[model samples]
Target chain A: MLHVFGHLNPDTDAITSAVVYAGLLTRQGVEARAFRLGEPNFETAYVLRELGVELPPLLPELPAGAAVALVDHNESAQSVENLAELRVLRVVDHHKLGDLTTASPPYLRFEPVGCTGTLLLKLHREAGLSIEQQDAALMLSAILSDTLHFRSPTTTGEDRDAVDFLAPVAGIKNVEAYALAMFAAKSDLGDTPAETLLRMDYKAFPFGDPAAPQLWGIGVIETTNPGYVFRRQGELLAAMDHVKAEDGLSGVLLSVVDILNETNHTLVLGATEAKVLREAFGVETQAQLANLGHLISRKKQIVPTLERYFAPDA
Target chain B: MLHVFGHLNPDTDAITSAVVYAGLLTRQGVEARAFRLGEPNFETAYVLRELGVELPPLLPELPAGAAVALVDHNESAQSVENLAELRVLRVVDHHKLGDLTTASPPYLRFEPVGCTGTLLLKLHREAGLSIEQQDAALMLSAILSDTLHFRSPTTTGEDRDAVDFLAPVAGIKNVEAYALAMFAAKSDLGDTPAETLLRMDYKAFPFGDPAAPQLWGIGVIETTNPGYVFRRQGELLAAMDHVKAEDGLSGVLLSVVDILNETNHTLVLGATEAKVLREAFGVETQAQLANLGHLISRKKQIVPTLERYFAPDA
Candidate 1:
């Protein structure tokens, strides 16, 4: 049997991508099962419930002796535990490659797209297969979530075509309105627990000297209005402190981004070479927070900034 | 228009693969042209002459602003001069990737096959297209040459299938006989000019500190009978010395391989670190030549040995 999943911290695209790709592999006479590496965030759960699709089983790690196919990501740091032990049959990702090597070449279909759903949609068409109505909507939702309703800089023409092809079949009358509604569903995080908020879309990165104890935990919270998260800044910082202690990380930075505004306000904890950070971003820290104006992406903008700051001098 | 070519020092596979893959791309509505990076070696010229196929034009370098697609090889060192310029449309290769990156992702169809022709055959079948007779023969010749008539360690089951599928279409009554004929055409190099022999299947690599000058010119001469080339050993060594002087290289080695016997004899020119070579191969040098018994592949065996010897201390 073949097991398929995305990178850790299962988001809307990661969950829907695994499900759709497994369907494609299954139609080709492979007994493939879609699973998630971790529990889905509220937005993903809400979308699945709306589409009336049962959530795949939550799997923390890939099972031993099973052939695994990864989707959405290829970074081992963000992949399941014991990833080096299993047989990797294939990989379908949209992100840049990380530290991944196989004894033999695994079939790779990596593209620089806004979402994995866009890639799978093309794959199905190329294989002469069709995605049905309910699944098509889920796939569309993933594209919207990843590309921020086609407003992201990563959105390409293929992504627009994927949205156009699926919207009618998905019974969506207005794509703009539908995307807005989806964004609204995840907006009210005011009453949520601080830990759940921090863990929603968390990623960890290691930097500086290889021997040094330094790791950065970054969490991104997408909202229509950035002020919602800013209101609870004190509580979120306390939660970030607890998260830093639990993970034994050197620092923690949270990107509270307003997708509608295309801006992110960064709140950080822990001391890590302020001189490097100030020089890299041309911003000074104010109360452990840096107001980064007009930041749309973590992968393209925020993460690269942090990585450059943490990179040791050559 | 897409211009497709192979690596430098055009081999039989390199020349024929460009021709067949250009046919595949042309069928898919792309105006493609096949060309060779350098002059064809004896075996490639012989096969083309038998098939009544015109040789691709010798293009020593790619033109600026031309959209190019590469086949058979992908190493920048072996690729066209000024490869960083121009638009790369696609890459169809069967070797380990080198330091190659594109401004954007090109249409990559890389596989770990014995030959690029084998991969193009699979692509045609997947796209529901057929290979015509003229192109089919070209593809078959490439497979035969790269796999050493299916005796090289790189030969796989897919390569066998390709040869089987193309044998009848190429109008060959006996596969073994056809392959032996091709091998025999390249065996009689006794009367050829020493410089031409050295340029037949030559490759160069840089090693050690980039600040200091160091280069290795490795040549492989495949023959059915090793003694035919061994008889001209003195002349070959003298030619190699001249090549070293002309190129101002640190070292040069030639692998005279007997494909029928599956063994290769190595001969070196110029002074390099003898202690490094001795520890790498664990064998003493005899007359500046080493009998690398039963090693026929430069990529898999000989080049790796030289690289290990030249590798700086970890």
Candidate 2:
């Protein structure tokens, strides 16, 4: 059986895309099961329960050469620890091409859309398969979460079309209401541990020369109420510092994204991250924060900027 | 305008797939033109002439950020000199995942099929576009050449189905006869320069640790007349030696594949190439030739074997 999954720090897209893709493959007579690298975020949990879908079980350590399919992400740093050892059967992703190599050719589908959900819908249509109502709901929720209800810079016409096509099938009458409720659920982080908050939507990235890339951990907290996060900035910074040292990361940052305002106010753990923000984004760090104005979409706005700044020739 | 092309040392699939895909994109209201990184091999030339289709012009160096699309191949080492600078808009490939990175997500479609033509047909269908007679002929020829008329181990069921579907559309009355003619055209190497023969279907690959990979150049000569290739062994070996030195490659290999017999007899340039063939395949070199029996598909058999042998853990 092929295990299907997405990246660690399971956001709505990462968690639900695995389920939708696994269901699609299963309908095509492939014995595949969805798995999560970590616990789903609050919004993802809300989506699963609201859609009456079961939470995917956490992935266990599999022996080398186990077949797997990846969704939403293709980067090894964001995937399973044994990614190199496993045999990747397929990848459905929306991120930039990553450090992925296979012994043989595999099925790969990547598009520059806001969400993997948009690509999954296309895949189902291409396969001449009817989308299940639950799967459609999962895809709709994921698209809304990933695109921030079409407010993100990464949102494309295809994404909007997907939502429009899937809304009725998913039994969603008002997408705006559902999206706001999901955001509310996402922001309902009452006294969650500092480390848990920092890890909810984090990913490790390698920059500079690929041979000896500098590893950095970046976390994001997307919510309508950014002030709620700012109140716990002290704890979040301490957790970030601890994670940076523990993971031997070159630097660490946590971007608190104001979803409604479409702005980014990133917390800097140290001088290293501050220097990168200053040099890479021309933003000064004050009071342990860097205001990366209107740079809310990490995949579109933040990561690419940092990638160019740390490029080997740069 | 988007320029579509394949890998260096363009083969039938490499040259024709670009033309077919470019035409597909153009019909969809995107201004895309096909280009070739290198001159077409004899078989590709025959296909173009027989179909009365113009040869894709050789690609010139483009300015940084020029929009481009890749077909047949994706690895930077096998691509244009300024591949890193070019903006890759889409990639339709049938090869393993390569060291490709982008600033943003791009349209990527990869499958472990025998030919890119199969995927191109699917792409055209998904786009709700009709395949023109000329485009169909190009795809059919590419599928036949790449799969060695379904003799190669890389040939899959989809490739056979594609050929069956395309034969009528391409207006080819006798499929077998057409395939034999293509093979004959590919085999007619009559007095071509040794260097030219060696480079007609060659690609550079990087193996071992990705940070500092060991680069090797692999060349394949697939034909119905293997005796003719072996007869020019000395000159070919000299050409291989010159390329290995000139390119500063770690190793160079030229495999002469007998399409009918389904066998590989590779020329070993030096001690480095000889040792790798021996250790990797357990085949002894005799008279500077290593018999890699029944390993006719380079993409399926030879490259993967070498990749595993050169793996960091291996």
Candidate 3:
């Protein structure tokens, strides 16, 4: 059986895509089960509860050479620690290609869309399989969460079409209300530790040259109430410092995104990150904060810009 | 407009896949034109002539950041010189992932199938596009050539199904006879320069550590009349030596495959390749020849073995 899962810091898209993809594979006669690399974030948990679906079990360490399928991510840094030892059977992602290699070819499906849900929908259609109502709901919620209800710059026409086609099957009467409720659930941090908050949607990335790339940890907090996050800026910076040192990261960045306003206010961790932001974005960090206005989508707006900045030629 | 092309040292699948994929994109309202990175091989030329289809023009150097689509291969060592500078808009490949990175996500489609033609057929069906007679012929010929008429280890059920479905649409009554004719054309290497023969189906691969990987050139000559090739063993070895030196490759090996017998007789270039083959395959080189018996498929049989042998742990 193929063990299917997504990246660490399981967001709604990452968690839901694994389940939906596992279902698709099973329906196509492949024995597969969904697993999550980490605990689901609050929004994903809310989505699971509202849809009356059980959360996918957290993945345990598997023996080396175990066959697995990756969804929503292909980067080794964002995946399991023993990724190099495992035999990757399939990958479904929507991010820039990263340092992932296999001894043989695998089934890989990638597109520059807002979410993996859109690709899952395409997979179902191509396979001539009808989407189960639960699967449809899972995909619909993931699409809205990832695309920020079509407000994010990552939103593509294909994503919009998928939502339009799936809404009826998902039995979603008011997408706006559901999205708002999800966002509210996400924003309800409610005394969670600063480290937990910082890690909720975090990922590690390697930048600069392919050989000897510098590792960096990037975290995102998407919420309706951005002010609530900024109020704990001191604690978040301490958490970032601890993580950067523990992981030996070259830099760390935490972008607190205001979902409703569609703005980004990133917390600069140290001199390394501050200098990089200043040189890359021409924005000065004041009081340990960089007001990266209108940069709401990390996959669309942030990662690409940082990639170009750290490009070998650049 | 997207310029679609295949890898250097173009094979039948590489050349034809570019054309068929360009056609698929055009059918989807994408402005795309096929190009070839290098001259077509004898079998590809024969397939083009047999179908009365014009060969794609050789690709010209475009400015940095020009959008392009890749088919058949994706590794940088097998691609254009300035592959890193260009923007890859789409990639349809059937080989193991290599050092491919994009600033943003692109449309990537990869499968563990025998040929890119199989994946192109899937793309057309998913898009609800009818296969044109010419495109069907191109795909069928590619499948036959890449899989050696279903004799290659790389051949999958999807590849067989594709040929079965495409035979009539391609207007080919006898696939066996057609495949034999193509092979005869390919085996007609004739008085071609030894260097040309060595490069006809060659690719450079980076093995060992991805960071500062050691580059090796692997070439294959698949022919029905293996005796014709063995007669020129001296000249071929000289050609391999020249390529290894000229490219500063760590090692080079040219496998001369007997298409009829499904056997491999690889010519070891120097001490490096000899030691690797000895350690990896437990085969000793005699008279500069290493008998890699029954390992005919370079992708499915050869590269993976070499990769495992050079793995960091191993």
Candidate 4:
């Protein structure tokens, strides 16, 4: 059986792409099953219902000793824990390269697109697969969610290409309507602050300092109310601070999404240089914390900004 | 197996709703499988792919004996051929009621909202089904597509309620972004006129003297180019006129959608009541034919306009 898996803390794109791609493979006579790493947050559930598709079973943890084909997330040894133990058969993602093993290489398919769904769309087209309507709708939703509905800075030609390809198949004459509906659904913040915080997927990265093994932790909080976000900023920071002190991390970053304005309010805590935030974000901050809006996503928006900050020195 | 079917010539909402609803049912230990009536059009395919879900297998000619659970389209024996033979087990639609057999019905869930997917979302909630991320995304997409991203006049409280329920699960903070992307993708009309016309789902209805039944078809044509639409109008009318004259139809109506503007331009032919067109559309026409712009939809905009002129007393 072909095991189609996506990254830890899967987003709509990551989860949906895996499922659709697996379906395509199944239709082509391949035994395929779709799976996701981590539990699906609230927003992902909304998208699955809209597309009339079920979420693949959530993998309580990464595949410890199963053959896997990864999608969406980077495939560094750290990203795919126990990678050496499992047979990495394939890698399909949209992120920049990590330390992937070339000696025992998998079928790596990485493109500079906004979502892994776009790459899968290309493969489906190239393979001349008979795309069904429901599958098309799912792919379209994945692209919309991953690219922040195509507003993310990391969106590239491939992302737009896939959207253009799938738009007609989805029977959507106007994409704006779908985007607005998705945003309106996601912007409600009536839940507890912790729920909102945990509803999203997060990643932890090594800060490149051996002395402080846990260098940084990042999470995204998508919402509409800037006031609510500002109100809860302290709580999030305190939690991050505690995690950082306990884990001996250098810094923590949280991207609070302002759904109405299509911007991100960045919150930084810990020992990272304020200059790093300022240089990457082009905004000055005196306090150990920074609240910068309009950045939206760390992978698409924040990471690029961080790269710019690191480019001059490194 | 539990057959989960949608309307003939299913749209994104129809197809996606079927797939997701089936998924939910299957998760609940029901042996559910999704089915579509006809070949999936372009937009529906895009939507399904985005969700990473398999498109249900195309039903083998509307189930001569199989029980059907209809979604989106209303159940009218007059509209659906061979309805007298096939067993319609259940109907979950969000449209004006047509004559249906409710006396010996299986489950019947009808709501006057923008889409069938909205009703499905309610059912998921009522059943206390825990939706997966992909399913939630699909539902979110369906809401946007059916409600014109909440801009359509047909939008109702139920539609909004469905959106509110599904947005968080889809992980969308601002649906406007998704709407914009979906609209932008649809606005690009590089394909031929026939391709564009076939991209959307279509339905046929009998229009004429009750004694002489004939098909007066109405199908949505999504495109941005008014000139292309204007040209296609002639071709569509000629084709429809040929079919009408051959089959002794009284008239036919075609709705050309300028998806970007959320407006419909109608082309009416074969009917003698040109004044009905004038009175309903506020556009005076000679030569026994009419072409009108700024209309909403054939069901919401054209039918009311025509009914006023044809059967003013009713």
Model 3 Cα lDDT, one tens digit per residue, B1-314: 89999999999998999999999998889999999998899999999999999999999988999999999988888999999899998999999887787778989999999999999999988888899999999999999999999999999999999999999999999999999999999999999999999999998888888766788889999999999998999999999989999999999999999988989999998888999999989999999999999989888888888888887778
Scanning candidate 2 chain A in windows of ten residues, the lowest lDDT window is A96-105
DockQ of each candidate's interface versus the true one?
0.14, 0.82, 0.80, 0.01
The regions of model 1 sitting more than 4 angstroms off are A1-91, A94-107, A111-114, A117-144, A147-314, B60-66, B188-191, B205-216, B241-251, B270-278, B281-284, B303-314
Q: Tens digit of lDDT per residue, candidate 4, span B195-282?
A: 3363254565544333344444566765545566675556666665665566454555556667667666666674443555666567
Distance from true position, residue B87, model 3, in Å? 1.1
What is candidate 1's lDDT per residue for B157-207, written digit by digit as tens?
Answer: 989999999988877878898888889887866578887888789888766
For candidate 1, the per-residue lDDT at B198 reads: 81
Interface RMSD of each: 4.4, 0.9, 0.9, 26.8
Q: Assess the local accuracy of residue B124 in candidate 3 as a C-alpha lDDT between 0 and 100.
A: 89
Docking class of 1: incorrect
Query: Tens-digit lDDT track for model 1 on A91-202?
Result: 7877654555443435567667888899888778777887788878988999999889977777888899999999998898898987887788777665888777887888
* Model 4 / residue A295 / CA error / Å: 3.6
lDDT of 3 by residue, A1-314 (tens): 89999999999998999999999999899999999999888899999999998999988898999999999999888999999899999999999888887778989999999999999999999888998999999999999999999999999999999999998899998988999999999999999999999999998888888767888889999999998999999999999999999999999999999999988999998789999999888889999999999988778877778888998988
Residue B70, candidate 4: alpha-carbon lDDT? 63
Best by lDDT: 2
Over 4 Å off, model 4: A60-65, A76-80, A193-199, A207-214, A270-275, A279-282, A286-293, A305-313, B1-314
Instruction: State the weakest 10-residue window (summed lDDT) of model 4 chain B.
Output: B97-106
lDDT of 2 by residue, B1-314 (tens): 99999999999999999999999998889999999999888899999999999999999889999999999999888999999899998999999888888778999999999999999999998999888899999999999999999999899999999999999999999999999999999999999999999999998889899778888999999989999999999999999999988998999999999988888999998888999999999999999999999998888989999999999987
Evaluation by DockQ, superior candidate among 2 and 4 = 2
Two-chain DockQ for model 4: 0.01
Q: Residue pairs in steric clash, candidate 1?
A: none
Query: What TM-score against the true fold does each predicted structure earn?
Result: 0.69, 0.96, 0.96, 0.46
